[model samples]
Target: MMKTRVCACQTKDVYLPERARVVASEPMTATERFLAFELESGRPLGHQPGQFVEVSVPGVGEAPISISSSPTRGAAFEMVVRKVGNVSRAMHELKPGDPVGIRGPFGTSFPVGGAMKGQDVLFVCGGIGLVPVRSAIQYVLDHRKDYGHATILFGTRTPAERLFVAEAAEWARAPRATYMETVDRGDGQWTGSVGVITTLLPKVTIQPAKTVAVICGPPIMYKFVILELRRMGLSDDRMYVSLERHMKCGVGKCGHCQINGLYVCQDGPVFRFADVAQIREAI
Candidate 1:
């Protein structure tokens, strides 16, 4: 039997937040805000797609936000923050030119490098899961020549609740890309497919043996999606899932993000299903 090897993470005072300036802020939904920020000195956040950064609102506190924009895009990074609590509420109140604190570009990232070149890629994002998957999708789109066929599946509760409304349309029409979107429930104005995100899987044309599936969403969504992927003959090693938690500290010190013995904040916010499947706490 082959042993599973976990990546080593170097620890430091990863809690120290860097000063950043909000260059743009737009409301994506009633509870979510789209924010673009750059470091004080204009240094790139240097984060890979699927990694997360801690954004602080002065005394209000800090919260982990997935880097939504791909580094291949530009110097600045973006985050789609949902206003679920006090810290997020403060983040939503931020405007262009406002100052904020940022710590880390932490956690494991989706492998879009050499290993993924020329391979079919399928991204399954549910609701807010699209926030992080957007980065990976953009990276592939920008370097389209380096990969094989690429597909993106997005599911939300309604048309009004969708994120990246404009980009989603563009991707749907882009060459070599397959973009499908569905809503669990539709409104009078909604005309697209209506069903759970997993249902969209049947519409995708993928070579299971050559595809790498990246799945993220509410925990419950993972099970159904994985079941479908398995039915398609994809192995656990070929599938990756992002598991976000209350990582109180970006460094592994705070046990808040631990599942059994592994720290989700350090070992992953992104993990290959094969490694996570054995852990009882992991979905």
Candidate 2:
């Protein structure tokens, strides 16, 4: 167990975790919770959209979690965690003012501030996949004028499993933005579209030339979603994907996330679809 957390961190030391304080922790669903943390060093996390951080607890261990808030949000960073393992279970036990360990803010990020600016931005997310894509959504919305028409498409397995309900609704209502949500299975409370996320794609229109698509979800979702995007005329070069499933150790030393010449933790967790299209395991 950690006696006292480290207040500062060195990027050169890949094994160390910088101490951060929990500013807020709240439940988003039965199994998932929202956590916001502020670095004890009083500096911003400096993460771009679609990046992730490796988190730890005193007696438990470490897990890589996607950064759910945009870098434009503020000094603090946020994550929506599902209680599934020792570290995540311990993270659920944290409260306001408690200390936590954070490593990384690793991996590549969405091109919202770079190649994506001035072009139409399209975001496609599924279930908990929204946890990472939300950062780019927040960044795009925060600077809505920097891009063209913004379109967001989200789908979950069920109604109760929906994360960021209120915020997603707000995104739907934003000026110059279009938001649509669906669930594979819906309950009485779920009044939106009912089907896989691809069903909603046909109902919308986009500019194939100017639009940039950013996707995140399970590997299977990536396959089908890209199929529909391809049918819709979006090219692989204009698309980006988040493969957070392959994350491990938050560094290249661990080959758990390696695919041939690519290391998901180091080279990317977010990659241009064209760059990794030929790698069978990249999705």
Candidate 3:
């Protein structure tokens, strides 16, 4: 079969983007849209959790976007894109069948079946941070028997800002799965907890030493969340974080994502807390 490659620039160029067409597109919020794409090569994006890909639009440019859906779920990969800049704004204008260029399933990934196997998995996601952590959450749930209990804690500023309405409900229903969510401020219809994500942490009991926690959220949120986790007995080495950095080039050479000696694009967008704790700029 003939494949429709988006860029004929050849694979020798490390930045070459292959062709992909959007298979599904829906608005998750006023400013964010959920999109799914199938590579023209007829293969899956084959990405692991906590990784991102650089999307390219000819007239615009490239922007790094986290893979929001679990690789275990489907052939097409998904992303949660916010209309914050040029590339993303252009991405929002795309429809179900529009063609786009995809570069990689780049960067380090969460250790799901590896280090997390047979261990309790706890996920803490805040606001848009949930966008990337959702991938790991889905992986853990998909292979539920391979791990112990699954606890998910999510928080957003307001009810309107909550993402993944349907999926959140499913997580709550899964066996051996614990899902709790909160909004900093609630509305008339909001009946759940009302506070920052840290407030939800105390409600769940975890065997901290045997549990591996994956956290992704705002910069300010990390400090408080980690402090609370330490108070709960989880050590720095057992906790992981996904960072949002300025990774202009998915390759390490760009230096845009450098924090001390590490390049987030190559070293990680995802890292174990203890490994990066000393790098003042990394979080």
Greater lDDT among 1 and 2 belongs to 1
lDDT of 1 by residue, 153-249 (tens): 9999888889999999889887799889999999998889999998999888778789999999988999999999999889999999999788789
Candidate 1 lDDT score at position 194 = 99
lDDT, each prediction: 0.90, 0.89, 0.92
> TM-score ranking from best to worst?
3, 1, 2
Model 1: worst 10 consecutive residues (lDDT sum): 5-14
Q: Is 1 or 3 the stronger prediction by TM-score? A: 3
Give one digit per residue, the lDDT tens place, for model 3 in 139-251.
98898899999999999999988999998999999999999999999988999899999999989899987999999999989999999999999999999999988788898
lDDT by residue for model 2 (1-283), tens: 8587654443367788999999999999999999999999999998999889998887888888999999899998999988888888998899999998899889899998787999999899998889999999999999988999889999988888888989988998999999998999889877789999899899889899999999998778999999899999999999999886647688787788887789888888889999999997787
Model 2 ranges off by over 4 Å: 1-12
Whole-model lDDT, candidate 3? 0.92
By lDDT: ranked, best first = 3, 1, 2
- Residue 204, candidate 3: how far off, in angstroms? 1.3
- In candidate 1 the C-alpha lDDT for residue 87 amounts to 88
